[model samples]
Target: MPDDRVEVEEEPVSETRLSLTADCGSCFGLCCVALPFTASADFAINKEAGKPCRNLREDFGCGIHTQLRQKGFNGCTVYDCFGAGQHLSQGTFGGTDWRREPKSAQQMFEVFPVMRQLHELLWYLNEALTLAPAKPVHADLRELLARTEALTGGSAEELARLDVPGHRQQVNLLLLRTSELVRAQVPGKKRNRRGADLIGAKLRKAELRGADLRGAYLIAADLTGADLRDADLIGADLRDAQLAGADLTGAFFLTQPQVNAAKGDPSTRLPGRLTRPAHW
Candidate 1:
């Protein structure tokens, strides 16, 4: 099937952290073929699990690269390969491009997603370690950060054989420790308010799974990877909220408009179709 996934413009290089700016030009589009997507609100059309997008050229660049969104493939716009795609295509695999060696294509593609996932965890874990107040856990943080970085540099064959979920669990443990170190200082007492004003709060990774957030002002909140499953978002204003990697799978009373008004990253899994929240 034609790669109908929407593509967003390349973000400003400076917008990404220095740690993430590893060379990716050497990669041969392994991510495009390795990851799978089906037609839904996020994707424009249905595609088989392993089939390459029709727009992918023999050179491994998108044929509609510059016009992805215009061509009705917005999903591509929000994707960030985290340098994993290219790293495996060129560095780990010694620039053995997938096209020439058709047999290696599947393995190369498979490793891309796995490496990308590991890179994503490293990104968040690194971010957590940077918080000033989490200084108490500095020693542990440094150890974990080094471990995560080492994992990123693992060989393609090693990465392809990695257990991503298990790695994620280890990283999650550190993140939880980081969160506790920070939140422990802040009073957990809930303030009295009928409809509290929480607009644009930095609630990233907060455990709000079953919290009563009804009719609350949540505009532009950074909800990256927050556990919102089964939470009450009824009448909650989600305009400009960042739902990157957030889980709203079973969130209650989350109307389409509420989701439509917010900004969502590709990792943001919502209950239903609605283009990523508009205020990206």
Candidate 2:
């Protein structure tokens, strides 16, 4: 899959804090080459790892940067590397460009996925630390944050050999605690919607505030005008979900891919660090 440039907002993220955001200029198109994809509703063609996309430019920019969706490649618009690109292109490899140094290409490709997972964990840890009610686990969040951040600074070999899923399992425990602490503030018993198959379910104008929607298969579900504020959407399959006018303010762990897959409009509300998709 091809990669999109990072969306910037003055308050979305702070560069000095820890770059848990993409910096495409500092990357060598790793997301485009290091990842694999097959023909799907989201992608137009099949691409194998370590091979540059046909649309990749000499300077590593997407040739179809402004028209990815129209060209049948909405997957690129949805993908986020969480700043792993620059970390490998610069930090782990000493600012090396894979193009200039072809020998480093294989190693960089191999390590990119591991770095991406670590950076995603950092994204969750950073969000967990920001929640006020999660103070009970602040100390633990900090410890895990530091530990995950440290892993991001490791050498290429160290990153490739990392036990990423093991690290994620530990951090996920802390995040679950954070979710409980935050959702407890809402004035209702949380619903257990975890991994439920709600495909094409009519949920328009539903009162779902503070719902624990983690891992729900809500494909093409009608969520229009639903009160999804503070909803836990981690790992939710929202492909083609109707979110037109649905409130997602403070929705936790919602990724760009989810937003892109869903149907929405300008009236739809979003949390910080997320941009409205153009196709909407």
- Over 93-147, each residue of candidate 2 has an lDDT whose tens digit, in order, gives 8887888999999999999999999888888877766666788898998888889
Q: What is the C-alpha local distance difference test score of each model? A: 0.63, 0.83
- By summed lDDT, the worst window of 10 consecutive residues in model 1 runs over 3-12
Report the poorest 10 consecutive residues by lDDT, candidate 2: 1-10
For candidate 1, give the lDDT of residue 189: 35
Angstrom error at residue 110, model 1 = 1.4
Candidate 1: residue 49 lDDT (0-100): 49
Clashes of each: 11, 0
Q: What TM-score would each prediction reach against the true structure?
A: 0.61, 0.92
Which runs in model 2 stand beyond 4 Å of their true positions?
1-16
